[model samples]
Structure formats: C-alpha cells, structure tokens
Target: MKKTIYKKIHIIGSVGSGKTTLAKEISSLLGIPYYELDNVVWIRNKSGDIRRTEQEREEYLNSILQSDNWIIEGIHNEDWVSNCFQSADLIIFLDTNYLVRTYRIIKRFLKQKLRIEKANYKPTLDIFFKMFKWNRHFEEVGKVNFFNKYVVHKDKIKVINNAKCIKKYFN
Candidate 1:
C-alpha cells in the first residue's frame, strides 16, 4: 500500500477528541514539527490562570504556518487558521464516540494530576466540567457548520470515527 504523505497537516476536533495525541503521533511518524493550538491560544501562568489574547494568538499561529512541515492541532477554525489550511496536505477531523472521548478526557485529567503527563497548564475539575460544554459545541456548532462553511478541500479531509482507525490511518 502506498503511504500517505502530508507535508502540512491540520487536526481539528472538539475537546477530548484526541486531536493533540493523534497530531503528535502523526508528526513523529512523518518527522514533522507538531504544534498544539491551545498553546498558541492561551498563555499559561504558574498560578493556573489561562489568559487568551487574539492578537497574540494570531502571531503565534502565523509563526507556525510559516514553517514548511507542521502538524497543527486545535479546535479553533477561524479565518487565520483557515488560511493556513489552504496549504495543508491533509486535514483530519476526529469524530470519535462521545463516551470514548469522555473517558479519554477523564483519563488525561487524572494523568495530568498525577504528573504523568504535563499539560501547558494544569487541568482542574472546573476544566473537566467544561468538557461537557465543549463536546456540545463540537457536535452542534463546530464540526458540521465549520466543515460546511470553511473546509474547502473535501478530497483531502479524513474523518476518523474511532481510536482504531486513528492508528490505522497513521500506520
């Protein structure tokens, strides 16, 4: 089988959708830099408050898009990111089952709390509760409407429905 070669890839999905994990795996396999969009969007403090500025976010995203080969993963699909997608060889949308994603989210939170996996910022119970809202947004607003409106390269888009397919896609 001929392997897929994507020089610039964008992974977009909701919270708990495994976007970051999949992006990192794909980036390692393809030998490309992986960027977490949340890192660009929010400035983390040692005290745990996340400050987000649109201008700073834009600049950060601009720097990443200027790179040759990158895997950018995030839930934000604004105009700037959409422009970056124009050059993306592949755009993956992970629509894994809600129960699976919820479990992953909880597992990640516990891992983060245990210091097993370090996040850009600490994950709190408040953030855990917010996952419910994020999941709803992804289902009702983000995925369907955003894809319909902005995702122009239908041929390049791949929607993975499960973790098994995610591994298969990269393999």
Candidate 2:
C-alpha cells in the first residue's frame, strides 16, 4: 500500500461545496482524523447551538494543530483559522458551481430535516436560507480573497472543480 504524503490537510470552500464530505472521504483513505470547524465553533445541546468564545475556539483549534495528522474542513477563511492554512501540508479548495451548491444546500437541508442525513446543528428554515446567502457571499467575496491570500502557497493548494477532481486526488 502506498502511504499518503500529507499529514495535515485543510479543506475550505463555500457552504454545500462538499468540503466536509470530501474531508471525511480523504481522512478515511489516509487514516487521518477529521475535524469539522462547525464542531469547534458551536456546541450543540438540548436548547440549540451555543457559540464558543474566541479563546475556547482557538484552544480547541490549537489542540488539533498540535496533533501529528488531521483533516480539518470548514467554510471559515477568517483570521482565526489563518494558522491552519499556514500549517497545513495540503489545502483543498472546492470550487463547485453556484447552481450545484444551491441544489446541494436545499437537498442537504431536506435530508437533515427528514433525519436522512446527520448535521451538526438543527435544520431550521432560517439556517437553510442562510446557507444560500453564505454560498453567495463566498462566490462574491470570499473566493477571490481566499485565492489571493494563499497565492504564496500555491504549490500546496489544490482547487477541485468537480467530483472527478476530488477522486483524482486520492486515487
């Protein structure tokens, strides 16, 4: 068996862009632990999701970064996670089309509501709609900035445009 070269992988993209799914798949293939950023930022309980404080979030993130191998996936490209980008051995940027992302967001929400799919948070209508808004925000603002910010690390960055591209990475 061939060994995977990347020990610490970071995946980022717009909502419904399949960042988490791909992260899970790659983690399984590489036998690396996976961490979802949503899990780091929000604590789910009987009432709802309680946001973690900046310090708490940072501490949690630091613990993961200290580990030898991991695959961290999220839509977050903020200053708080810049360290992950800097430390990652590989960074995957999923760039599926907006239409595909919109469809995925709706499909995922329905699945979550019907208990056909698992989600980190409750599948409320507001959260469903916010997914679209977040997708658009990434398309208009976040995408370009992300590329620009990580241009220096272009050699380590992989832009996945479709499912085939994702499979190629592991195969």
Candidate 3:
C-alpha cells in the first residue's frame, strides 16, 4: 500500500453492518492498525472476556486516540467515544441496508456456531437473538444519534454501504 493519507480513521455501524470487515480492509490497505471497541471494553483471557471498568475503558480509548495512526471501529456513538469522531481524519458510517444487516446477523451466527468463523465471544443462542434486538435498536436510535453527534464533522464523514466505495475514494 502507498503512504496513508488518512492517519486516523473511525468507523461506526450496527451489528452485522460490516464495520469490522471494512476496518480490517482499510487497515490492511493503508497499513494502519485497527482496534475494535469491544476489545477495548473487555479484557480477553483464556477463562473469559472480563468487562473493563468505565475508567479503564475510557483510558484505553484515550491511549489509542493518542496514537499517530489508527483505525477504530465500533457501534458506540456515546459521549465517551465522541473524541474518536472528532479526532478522526476520516469517519465512515456504514449505513448498510437494514435487511442486509439482518441477513448478515443470521449468517454470522451460523458461521460461528459451526466453527467456520472465529468470534470474540461464545456464539450462544441467547447472544444470537440479542444481535437481532441490537440491530433493530441501532436502526431506530443509534443511527440518528450518530448523525446528530457527528454532524459537526460531516465534511470528513463518508456514509457508505460498502468498502469498495471507500477504496475508490481514498485511493
């Protein structure tokens, strides 16, 4: 990949919206490290993923933001993560179709359950069902909140449904 023009990139989307996929693609192409918000919120271990304290989460996120280059992706649009949007050289909102996301949720769960895909957490039936609820909530509430909170940074925000568009634009 050529030199990265975008030093800090923040990607936001709901469950199954392809945030991780897009972040990984961009990170690979741009040679920038990517961080998932879930990992920042949890301490992954052999026993189980332990939840991080609020202070710890904030501190961890701050440390990442302090870096010169990074690709941060998550569904979080809360005040705590506002700094990421503000600091990003580019912000991508993966406004994927609701139906497409729903399909992906189902597909992802099945893949994890069948051991075809690796998951950060166990792929339980309960978690699979919760992904649906989370998807709906994001469509109804999180999407709007994300726009309102980051409207000030609209110029740098790219509302995309696919990573292909990003590749074309950024390259």
Instruction: Please tell me which predicted candidate would have the highest lDDT against the true structure.
Output: 3
Clashing pairs in 3: none
Sort order, lDDT high to low: 3, 2, 1
**Which order, best to worst by TM-score?**
3, 2, 1
Candidate 2: global Cα-lDDT?
A: 0.90
TM-score of 3: 0.95
- Colliding residue pairs in candidate 2: none
Model 1: ten consecutive residues of lowest lDDT: 162-171
Candidate 1's C-alpha runs over 4 A off are: 1-4, 49-52, 167-171
Cα RMSD, each candidate: 2.1, 1.8, 2.2
lDDT by residue for model 3 (18-62), tens: 999988888888899999999998999878889999999999999
Error of 2 at 150 (Å): 1.9
The 0-to-1 C-alpha lDDT of every candidate, in the order given, reads 0.81, 0.90, 0.92
